[model samples]
Target: MSPQLGNERRAADGVHSGESGRFTSPVRSSRLSPLAAPAFRYFFVGQVVNRVGSSMAGVALAFAVLDIDDSASALGWVIAASSVPMVVFMLLGGAIADRLPRAVVLRGCNLVQGVVQTATAVLVITGYAEIWHLVVLQAVAGTVFAVSYPAFLGMVPILLPVEERKAAFLLIGQATSAVGILGPAVSGVLVATAGPGWALAVDAATYLVAAGLLLLVRLPPGDRSNAKPSVIGDFLAGWAFARHLGWVIPAASASLVFNALVSGAINVLGPVIADDTIGSEGWGLARSGQAVGVFVAAFFLAKVTLRAPMRAIMIAFVVWCVPMLVLGTHVNVWVLSASFVVAGAALSLLDLAWNLLVQEKVPEEMLSRIMAIDGFFSFVATPIGQLAVGPLAIAFGAGRVQLGCFALAALVAAFALTRRRITDVRLTGGPPPQLTG
Candidate 1:
């Protein structure tokens, strides 16, 4: 997702206007308007296809690991293997993306991902797969993603102008939500019938297709005359810009805590609990329900106007604790699925608001690096959490661990709300206010 102005411009008063003194951008509310641009159209199709495959792979990977070794500890190690590399290489990836053509970098990374995923699929399909094989393959995949994601974040501005971004983001979210609904259900069927290997193979094919699509996306050449002397210098510049923002550090800290405790507990232990209770098919439906919620939120938010977007976003963070609470206390699949719907809506809203905030506030020249720094800080603790959660579950039990994680998440949300700089910001389609340090 990238977006550009389509026959519309902002007037001197900061309101989008046409020759008739009224807003004229259909991109604001019409779902298909952004697709008019050839660049966004190609990018959108590829992204949707890729997301569908990746979502299926997410479920398939979990079950495949459990099939190999049913221990939570084993699954934890495999997931951590991937995340650790992402944390280590994320800044470098961002610097590279900033220095290169984003589309070309993304195209190359997708090709690598296809190859790695193909190899992993073959190993699993041939009955010679080991946990180590998966750990190694996923680590390679993670490295590719760490390099590609900052390009992904910054690509939107390049493809589309600022006026159309909110709509483009919402449209992308809607498409992702729709595919997310299908991916896990289809993955469950594939995993149950043809096996996880086939599901992963499908994921591999999508990457190749995405790579092909990226070839069609023509972007303006990036200016390299002001390039940093070194990768470290590029990163230091991004950090310098980021460190002065009062909200950035606290938000990053909250993200670190949230992903570490809340997300770790869910990803490591949720499947184990689901396997023992609702089974894989039901687990897939539960995830689909979450996607449905995301779609609903995206649909609703696109139609409404927000007076205080950041404040609403903070409230949504509190709602994110609902899923852990439900998983901790409820054994029924429907109840778990329903709770996930609420949590998913909250997550979708928060994600959209946060992305818009960053894109609006950060300068285009430094956007990729800032996004990389944000990702680096946000995910630095994730591998540690993933690695530890399984053993903690083994010691304290999954239910207790989930409940404890939920409590901690709630505390983090509460602390975040007390920061006036985070809560006071508004998105009103004007020049970004100078944020207080």
Candidate 2:
């Protein structure tokens, strides 16, 4: 069986243990002190900057694409181009994260993205950009994301004490949600007042800044002394472990279906519905409302100890149905915005819980690989979802397609309960201790 993250903490604490070898004490609860770590602090700042810039880029890109073609189909093709590579290269990226210095990998990816964005800005500014140009450049940027994502995730456990990681994730979520609140609007205004190209230049600058900060942040060069040199071998080993030795891979298998339903429905289709029903401004508010909910939940997660990790995750997931309901029913802006808020909080909580669990349980050497496999399957279906949703919406009414998507999400979350490993995870109760693992 796979060793749980709780067991790793149990081993580190030495104060408690059981036949199953997990920390049965509430002392294993997460703490917020990781925010005090210098390296993590810098990394945290970089993420915040990164989120803000990306948010701005989201608005800029939408305006840029629409300005040229004024068609959502053209926009979908641009998005699908980038997303395809992101899903395709994730597994290879995971192996690279394990084999190389994660910081170096992340730094390089960030720099490449910076260059890509600069190229995007130049193309837009020069008015030479075409749909084909964006598709190609976005493909390159998407591939870089495949590497940097696992690298960033794999590097986080190394940056903080084990006990501090849970809280660190919440803080990161808060930072991201909080910044995301303003990203689309502020960038939209800038795109309207100045131009999309200038806004893109701002995004490129943020990537450069984040990359520069990463240089000052030092981390352990991972242990390679005992490992095979082949990257493919490393990936196979990780797959073997998660498949045979642990439950993570199984959970990810479930999530793969989950993401396909949720990612596409909410991200790709929801906005289209919003445009048709609630209007574009209402859609923006709905997004901000979701951000607000996420920000609030992050603070709550930072403080509360989750005694039943998977139970909490599953319960939070029920809220996901609200979005599906809204889309199916053509709810007013008030209902749509409220649904977004609830769904956003649920999504953020899931992100925090899952990441914290992996960082704590998995050994550092294999964390990236496992993370890659997890993420690879988790998101590999996203491009399919994104690409298919548009056509699906065309074939079926967007409402019916979205309703079907939500049903899948609801069913997936419910399915999580049937997996004993996900539900079997137990966090000890009592006043949460400051530090233990």
lDDT of 1 by residue, 1-437 (tens): 12222221222122244543234444453666667667878888888888878989978888999999998888888888888899899988888887787889999999999999999899888889999999999999889889998988887766655666777888888898899987888888888888899999999999999999988887656555466799887777677777775667667777787777754777777888888988788788887877888888997878766656666776777676677887788778788888878988988888888788887777556677888887888889998888888888888888888889888877777887888877786677663333222
Model 2 stretches with alpha carbons more than 4 Å out = 1-32, 192-195, 277-280, 427-437
Relative to the unseen true structure, what is the Cα RMSD of model 1? 4.7
Candidate 2 residues 269-364, lDDT tens each? 765676567644565566676777788888777766666677776767667556778878766877877887888888788787777666655676
**Positional deviation of residue 372's Cα in model 1 after best superposition, in angstroms:** 1.0
Which candidate should be chosen as best, given TM-score against the real structure?
1
Quote model 2's TM-score. 0.86
TM-scores, all candidates, are 0.91, 0.86
Candidate 1: count the clashes: 5
Question: Each candidate: what lDDT?
Answer: 0.79, 0.73
- Root-mean-square deviation per candidate: 4.7, 5.7
